[model samples]
Target: MEQIVQAECCGKTITISTGKIAKQASGAVMIKSGDTMVLVTAVAMKTAKEGQGFFPLTVNYQEKAYAGGRIPGSFFKREGRPSDNETLTCRLIDRPIRPLFPEGFLNDTQVMATVVSADKDNDPAILSMIGASAALMVSDCPFAGPIAGVKVGRVDGKFVANPTAEELEKSDLEIVIAASQEAILMVEGSAAEVSEDDLLEAIFFGHAAVQPILAAQLELAKKVGNPKRDIPAPVVNEALKARVAALAKEGMKQAVRIKTKVERHLAIDAIRDEAIAALVPEFEGSEKEVKGFIEDLEYDLVREHIIKDGERIDGRDTKTIRAIATEVGLLPRAHGSALFTRGETQSIVAATLGTSVDEQRIDSLYGDSRKKFMLHYNFPPYSVGETSFRLAPGRREIGHGMLAERALQQVLPKHDDFPYTIRIVSDITESNGSSSMATVCGGALSMMDAGIPIKAPVAGIAMGLIKEGDDFAILSDILGDEDHLGDMDFKVAGTAEGVTALQMDIKIGGVTREIMAAALAQAKDGRIHILGEMAKSIAAPRADLSAFAPRITTI
Candidate 1:
């Protein structure tokens, strides 16, 4: 039987339909808004792969050429690998739903969203996100979702929910917000240095606007949704857990206090190994559980230290930022260069200038458009003291680069004012956490070093969250370890005047508006502090372009 539901959102109607196609899959839904349509399907393995320690969830968003009434541009006359936009859309869909699955359910799951039709006025990405959520909700995938995605833009002064493409071009703020019925789950967007309060308002506005869509999804699910699969509780050996805790408790307490990341990790690993060795003989066939308990102990200890003592792994207070060091014009031969180091994270950014011919030509469903500025982020293995294949830049690098690019794009001179094609390359020389934020700071300085007349200098910082029941703590300028162990990784970038870009992802179900507001306020302070430190190296754009830079003549 076909099940359909529709709701009015932002002056437009969104329709979701299921049970008409892809019926063999665990769940499938087709969502439409305006002329744009996206079909999303969810599937999961009946059982998890043996001994799989981590959940393997894949999300793929593909755009078919036929959907846009166009032929493939490639020589083969067919669609190729995932495009940058597709990869980013995949990420956006994945972020909110990844944390919704039960912890013990490690079954291999996949969510695929394919654009079946595209309209020039409406964006299919938002529809895809909504479809993914609806599909998961109807599936027997054990997913805790019924979330919705909305794109909020400010036209003139009012917040416009689900703005059209033409409206977005004129809007000063463009943010995509995904939320559940109660709280916002994911937010990623760029703005024109919009103030903090205005940004917060836009977020809640978007969140409120999606409530109708969420209602429609629930209605549809109630009619046709499959019974969710049962997830077995993790088997716990109380005796073994108690024994391992007793053996490693003291060592873990001492290990977590060490300031150096490498040293602390080594100490903890030593304790874990020692506990496993001593207990494995007695608790045979329980090595995995023993290791799990030790890890849990460490996780608990770290959170306790942070919440009760208000201290982080680096001994910084919740609101304090790490030491910052910056240098510009360090590479004499490059067009422009800057090295930005914050705590253990570092980025070496170089800027290059070119003519109109160098501008990137991007072809997409919305048609071809030329980008006057480009940013590429590279993360080599040696940056983290590791060794791996030097393949092409992966999706994470691309995503980070685009984020930093968005952070700086708002401040760049208009194409009419500065017609030269600009490209900034950020190479992460070292990383602990917030490397993307470091890229943002370094990219700004490098552009200034190249004599680009930017509107203002931009800086970025990453904030973390640790929530346990009624208590929660937000950490500013979080380290890599904190990002892994904490519940949220929220990054904000902007000029001292306001915010330019924001990206947030969380492991928990979601956070309240109050928490989001607090995080943004803390991020603003950290961003300002980082900016002040950055100004010490180079206060503004240079008086002239680099001597080696090519001079462009506007026709």
Candidate 2:
């Protein structure tokens, strides 16, 4: 039996159904908004894998070539690995719901969102997000979520929910906001010189618009949703946790305050070893619990100091920017190059100039589209003082590159003004925190180094939050530790005048608009300071490009 439900949203019909297709999946749902449609499935193993420390939640978003009436243009005549767009869409779906699952219920869950139909007017990214949430709601998994996503645009001072692809091109703001009925989970977007107040208003409006779609999904789940699984909670020896904490408490407390990452890591490991040697004889079969307890203790201590005492791990003020260095035209043969370093995070970005014949042609459901301006970000393990094999770019690399690209897209010259194709590559040589923001600063300098007439120099900064009960603190230019332990990862990019790109991911239920306003204001100040440092190296585009750069004489 097929159960279907519909809702009116943003001047369009949003239809959702289940039980008609993908019945083999543990849970499946089809979601439609405008002419765009997506089929999402939720599945999980009956039991978790042994010794799996992290919850394995995979969200795969695919665009079938046939969705937009196209065929595979590759030699294999089939879909290969996930494309950049697909990977980014996957991250969008993964960020909001990953934190909503029951603790210790890691049963190898996977949520797959396949775009079966694309209208080219409405993006399938948001539809995929909604569909994945609905599928999880109907599944037997212990997912504590019923989230929905929306795309909001600002046109002529009015907010438009689920704006069309055309309207987005003309609009000054392009934001995607995903939320539960009570709280927001994720936010990603780029805008013009919009104020903090207007941005908050747009977000609130988008939240109100998503209620209808969420309501429709809930009604559909009620008709065909399965009974949640009955799995017993894992046994934890409370005595083991207490003993381990008592043994390692002082050592970890001292380790947490170490300024450098390497020293802190080594110190924590030593404490763990000492505790294990002392207690392993008594607690023979409780390795996992002992280790988990120690980690939890460390997390609590670090979070407490930040929220209560305002003591950052690096011993810096909450709003202080890290030491920065920026330089341009380092590569002699390349068209343009710039090396940007802020504290430990660094990137050597290079710009390549080409002709119309060199543009990258993307063949997807949206048909063959050519991108004249592109950015690629690469991160090698060696850059992070580690050892690992290298392969194709992963989700993090793709997401970061896309973010830096969005940050620079607003400042690039129009197609008619700059007829040549441009591409920038950011090679991370070192990373500690906000390498994505480093890429943005590096990309801007590289373009200017190549004599690209960008409207203004763009820079980025990452902001973090530490929230405990009613208390909270926002940290600007956060270190990697703060980002890992903090409640929010808020990244903002723009010129000195205003913001051009913004992304926020929260681990808690949500944050108030007041916090967002404060973060945005702080980010602006940090961005201006970074740009001032960048101006010292090269303030604007050069008179001419490199002598060895590609020359394309337009006829």
Candidate 3:
């Protein structure tokens, strides 16, 4: 039987149907808005592979050339590797849904969204996100979601849901929000220096807009949903856990307060080795389980210290930002260069100027276009004090670079005013946490050093959260360890006047409006403090471009 559900969203009708196509998939749905259509499917292995230590979920979002009535222009006459747009969209769809899976379920799962048709007025990325959740809801896989996504824009002081491309052009704020019926799950987008209040309102508006879509998914699932598989409970050896905790309690307490990343890690490792060696014979063939128990004890201890004692691993308060230092013109031969260091993290960013001929030409479903600005981020193994075969840029690097790029995009001069093509390369020499934010600060300083007439300087900061039932604490400028054990990782970037870009992901179900408001307030203070420190080096754009830059003249 075919099931279809329709909802009116922002005066436009959205249609979602199942059982008519991709019948062999575990679960599949076809979603359409305007003339744009996306087919989303979810499939998972029935059993976990042996020795699988982590959940293996992969998401792919692909755009077909024929969707927009175009042919492939490559030599092979076929679509090639995933483009930057596709990769970014994949991350957009993955972040919110990844956490909704039930713990202890280690099956190899994959979700794919393909754009089957395209229209001039509608964007398929948002539609793809909705379809993903709907597909997962009806599938047999164990999922804690039936979430939905919406794009919010403010045009002429009015909030618009799922705004068209033309409306977005006239809008000052653009944000994509994903949420469950109860609270917001993920947020990612850029704005034109919107205030904290305005941004918070936009988020709530988006949350309300997605309610109808969520209802439609539930209705569809009621009609044709399959029985979900049961997730097995993880086994716990109480005796072993008690033994490990007793031996390592004192050592773990002191280890977390070592104040340095390298020293702290070393101390923890020593404790782990001693415990494992001492208990290997008694708890035969369960070294991994013993290791897990020790880690859990450490996690609980650290969270207790922060919540009850109001102390962090580095002895800072919940709202204190780390020390910052900045320098410009570090590379003489380069067009412009800056070194930005915050606490233990650092980025060396360089900017280069080029002519129109150097603009990156992108071939897409909508046709060809050129980009005047590009930001590239690189993370070598040595940054974390490890060694491995250095490869090309991976998904992490691309994602971080695009985030920093969006943060700076709000302040760039118009193409007509500054015709030179600009490129920024951010090399992270050291990283403990918030390396992407370091890139944001360095990129801004580098561009200004190159004499590019940007509208304003930009800075970024990453925030974390630790919640225990009714008690919760929002942290500012979190370190690497806090991010690992916390419940949320939220990043905010912008100038002193307002926020330009925001990204958030949470490990819990979702966050309340009150929590989000507090996090945003704390994040704004941290961002402003970072900007003040950045201003000590260079406050404005240089008086002239580098002598090596190409001179531009109207033809």
Candidate 4:
């Protein structure tokens, strides 16, 4: 049986049809808005790879240049590798659905989301997530889904569900959230610094509004879902687990007792190296696997101790932030510069105010677009205490930069309020964790240093979660290792009164509301603490732009 469902989203009619396209795929769907359409397909490999512990699911989101009646910009005039935007969109599609799959089903799976057509006013990221979920539900992939996503915006403190591109121009919040029928799976966006309560309200509203879409997917799945394939559960050797656990126990205990970020990391690395060497004699055939398992176990133990025992790796309480230092006008020649360091993560954010002529004009499938504010994030090799090639910003850097950009967009002065085209560059000098949030803090201070007179000061904090069965701990201002080992990364940005932006990603099955509430509460405490540190250096934006920066006059 084939089915098609239609509804109004962001003032446009959105239609979804399954069993009509890519019929051979386990599950497939076509989503359309006006003439712009997207075909999403999902397929899982017949067999799981032996000894492959990680889920081998891959998501590819492609934007055809021809979709918008344009040729590729490159000299080849053909699409090649995925652009940064496309890669991030693929990641967005991957994050929400990946967790919804059943654990232990490690079959090779692929989800392809292609924008066959695109309307200039509608963004394809949220729709792609929707299509991906629809396809998985209808496929034999064993997805615990019927998940749906929406882009929420804020204008004059009112929340708008699935706002169009034009509406986003006037909105302070550009939030994308993916949710199952019961809980949110993924959230990423930028906000102006909205209150904590408002942020939670927006999440609830988005969840409620997307429920109908989830219902539609479930209905389609019932009609066309394929018979799920059987895959063996991932096996863990009992002996290997026990041996490695013993090796890491004491070292992990010492690592967690340290007080500073750098010191703790050094101790952990030494412990891991020693454990790997000691385990080589016990497991000759699977030495590599044994070491990897040990490291993961060490992380798990650290997180459990933090949550259950009320202890952190860096010895901070659950609500405590790392030490913070702020300095303005750090660079003599820069228009406006500020260096903000929270624990070991440091960002030197510089602001360059320009006239309307300096605004960036971007040509894309959506057509010509002008952006008045641009935020660029750079991560050099030395930032992480490593040495590597000096190339262009990779997808991670670009994605992180964009996240920070969105976080700060909520508080930027409007064209009517201040006519300058603002560009902020965050140079990460050191990174242990959450450089993007540091970019937000530093960008705010830099704009103030440059005298942009922004509406309000914005701050951001990264929250981490460690879950063991029913026991869970929410850590505010988590370190890099905690992020890697934790189950969830929840970032919130906002003003003292409300939230401006929120983004959440989970590694395991979607988190319950109880965990989300805890994360939000912890984030607020960390955000306020960070804002207090920022206030000590500068309380508000300056009254005049830097002489070096271009001046713009509004009519």
Candidate 5:
């Protein structure tokens, strides 16, 4: 069935049509906004792999040269590994839709969105997120989503939904919100010191604007939806579960309260091994099941303690930030280097100044695009005290680096003013929580140390939420444990003036605007405190670049 569903969103026509492309897939949709188009297709494996523990869904978003009327610029003339932009876009589409599936439905589902067309003004990522949702909604998979995504920009004082590039350039905000009619499910964007109240209004306004787009998706699914295949529910051994719970409850509580991250991890491992030693004989060859039960219990214990007892794993108040320290000009030979440490989390961020020759150039359908400012983030396993071998930078590193880049993008001097290419590399040597925010703080310091005349010194902080129906606590400078066990991770970055960047992701189905407002306020305070501590290191940019760095001047 070739069906096209259309809607008017923020003065632009959005068209989602199915049945014409990738017909063999479970579900497929082509979304168009102006000349920008993305073709998203969803596919589910016929059967789950034996002992598949987690949902094996993969979302890949790619940009083809043909989409933007360009050719792939490579020796082989072939597309290879995903670009950082594509990787970040994949995260954008994956995070919101990943949770809407049944917990036990491990159907190796895949959603792939390719930018088949690009209008330079419109971003394909927004369309990709929308297309991914629409494809999954109509797929023969148990996806409880018809989620709609929109880009919210505030220029001057008024909010604009899905604003143009020109508007975004002048806007103080660039927020992307994904919703499910009931509440906001996913949000990731950067702002320019926007207030908590204004950010809240923009969120609500984005929610309202997506209603029609959601309706259009529903209509499209109605016409060309597939018959969902039902995978049998995961069978549970309640008797075995009860026995493990009774045996490990007290021991687990003791393990979670350990002060040090490594000690606590070791204790949990010992407990898991002890539990397995006790249960494996009874349920022979079901060691995986036994281990899974204990892990679930671990999550329950941590989450319940936070929500019920108003307790954090680290024994800090809900709104209390951890002790912070900052240092700059650490590397004598480098252009710029800063060390930002917040409790167990730390970042060694270095900035380099370059000329026009050093600008990162990407040849795509969008034409010869160049960026003067680039940020790279690296997370080695040793940072988290893991001994496992590591691979190349994955989606997390790319996403984190991009977030930090956006956090400081507004404060950067214009190319004409600075006439230099700037690159910031943030290395996570130790991590507990919000290493990306640490990057933001360290990146700013490194830039100043490199003598980039940034408008202001920037800092960032992560705010968490532990909500239990009516009772909720907004946490500041959350630890890794809280992030894993809590309801929300709301990260805000900015200078003394206001918020320059923000990102929020929730485990629960949706969070109210009230919670969002509270998180923003709390994050702002935390950011300010972090900035104050950073001031002890360097108040402003140095008057001169390093002698090692090349001098950049307008010719």
Candidate 6:
């Protein structure tokens, strides 16, 4: 028997169905919104790969031009490589689900989410995750899923779930969160210097709204779910583990105690090298086993410190933000600019106002799209105090920039209200903690410095967690060292009234609501403090934009 359910998120009705299409796959579902529809299919190989240790799960998100009643623009007249936006959507779909799969299931699995229709106003990323989860729940694949995703925006200090693209433009905070029934799985967003408390509240708002979506998937699963497949678990050698632990115990402790990111990483590398060299003589045939032992030992040391002492490697309190400093109009030539520093991280953000022609044109399978607000993040070798040959922004840079862009999106004026293309560039001059959040803070100041009539100023802060067994410590405005040794990275951005953007990534297992709640509460205090410091530099936006910036009059 097939099941279909529909619910409203933001202003759109999301309909999900399973057991009616692609029945041959382990699990499959069709999701629809307005005239736009997407088909998500999940398939897992019966047998695990010989050497593949990680869960071989792949997520593909494709947007067909025909979905929007448009044809391809290229001479070939067909889709080519995935666009940057599509790649990002795929990442979004993958991150939340990848962590939720049951441990020890190493089967080669694939989750494909294809958009057959698009309304332009409603993004397909969140919908795709819903469909993917539904498909997985009903499939024979062994997945610990039933996750749902939603986009939260802040408008006039109120939180809106699944906000429309139009509403987001006017909001000061834009956050996307994916959650399971009990805990949040992933978060990604940008903010306009909202309070930490508001950000936490918004996350709860999103999580609560997503509960219905998860219920819908479960309902469908119970109706047509296939029997889950059985797979054998990987084994660890007790003898080899004991030897490796004895050799690496002392070195791993020292590695976790190092405060600076560079120093800690260097210490870890040296320890691993020494361990490998020592093992080459004792265990000539078990080099791989020896290497794995060293890694696990290092992780154990870091996790134990957090769980036992409630202390971070850099020695910070759970609710403390790093040292922060703000400087506005740092560059004379730029229309508006601000250099924001948090702990060791620093971002020089500049705002440029352009005419309509200056707007960015995005070409994708959907069609040609123009964006009035743009945020670009650049990471140079100097930021990390290292040297690299790569010249252009890599995937990480693009992804970070997009995250910050979404955070501040909620505060941007409506197109009709302020008709100018606003571009924000965040040049990472130094990085030790959260550069993207710094970008959000600097971007807000830069926009105001340029005299853009933003609804409010937005700020962002990165939160970290060190967990071992049941013991854990949540750190606010974390430094790079804490991030590296931490198990969870929970970032929240927003204003005094509500949250705008949030993103969380967990390395071990998922967290509980209690932990998430505590983290949010601490984050609120840090966010408010950061905002107070920013106000000292510039309280509100200037009345007029810089003379050098282009002026646009809406017709």
| lDDT scores in order | 0.92, 0.88, 0.93, 0.82, 0.88, 0.81
Count of clashes, each model: 0, 0, 0, 16, 3, 22
Residue-level lDDT for 543 in candidate 3: 96
* After superposition, candidate 4 runs with Cα above 4 Å error: 1-14, 23-26, 47-53, 69-84, 102-108, 120-122, 154-160, 165-172, 260-266, 551-555
lDDT by residue for model 3 (501-551), tens: 999999999999999999999999998889889899999999998887788
What is the Cα-based TM-score of model 4? 0.90
lDDT of 2 by residue, 281-320 (tens): 8989666677788788888999888877777887777898
Q: Residues 1-555, candidate 1, lDDT per residue (tens digit)?
A: 999999899899999999999999999999998889999999999988999999999999999988999887888988899988999999999999898999899989999999989997777989989999999989888989799999999999999998887899899999999999999999999999999899999999999999999999889989984788888898889999899988999989989888887788889889988998999999888889988998899899999999999999888999998889999998998899999998889999999999978988887876788988899999999888889976588889989988999999999998888889999999999999999999999999999999999999999999999999989999999999899889999999999999999999999999998899999999999998899999999989998999999987778
- Per-residue lDDT of model 5, residues 1-555, tens digit only: 689989898888999998888999988889998899999999998888997888998999899988877778888887877877788889999888877888789868889999888997778998998899899878888888888889999888999999988998888888999999899998889887777788889999999999998998888878874667776778999988998999898999999988688899899999899989998999888799889988888888987887777777877767778889999999998899999999999999999988889989876667778988999999999999777566578889888989999999989997888898888999999999999999999999999999999999889898888877798888999889889878888888888888888888888888998888888888888888888899999989999989999985567
Clashing pairs in 3: none
lDDT (Cα, tens digit) per residue for candidate 6, span 1-555: 578887766566789988778888888889987776899999988888786667778888898888888888878989887777887888888888887777788888899998898886676888898888888898887778789998888787788887776888788767778888888788777666556656667877898888878887877777774677775665888887897788888878877788777888798888888877887787677777777788788767766776677666767646667677898989888999999988778889999988888988887645678998999999999888788999687667887888888778888888888988888999999998889889989999998898988888887888888766766778888777667667788777766665667778876556777888788777777777888989989979999878788766656
Q: Is candidate 2 or candidate 4 better by TM-score?
A: 2
Residue 549 C-alpha lDDT in model 6: 81
Model 4 local distance difference test score: 0.82
Which portions of model 2 miss their true places by more than 4 Å? 231-234, 552-555
**Which TM-score value belongs to model 2?**
0.96
Q: On a 0 to 1 TM-score scale, where does candidate 6 land against the true structure?
A: 0.83
Tens digits of per-residue lDDT, candidate 4, 1-555, equal 678877665466777898767888877889987777899999888777887767898999999988898888777988888866898898889888887777788788999998988876667877898999988887888888888888888777788998867778788667788888778889887665555666677777888888778877777777664666665666778887787777777767777678676777788778777876887766777666776776776676787778778878777877889999999989877789999999999999999878888998865787677889999999998888788876588777888888878777777766887787889999999998889899989999998999887777888899998888888888899888889888888888777766766778988767777788778888887888888999999998777666777665556
Instruction: Tell me how many residue pairs clash in candidate 6.
Output: 22
- lDDT agreement of model 2 with the native: 0.88
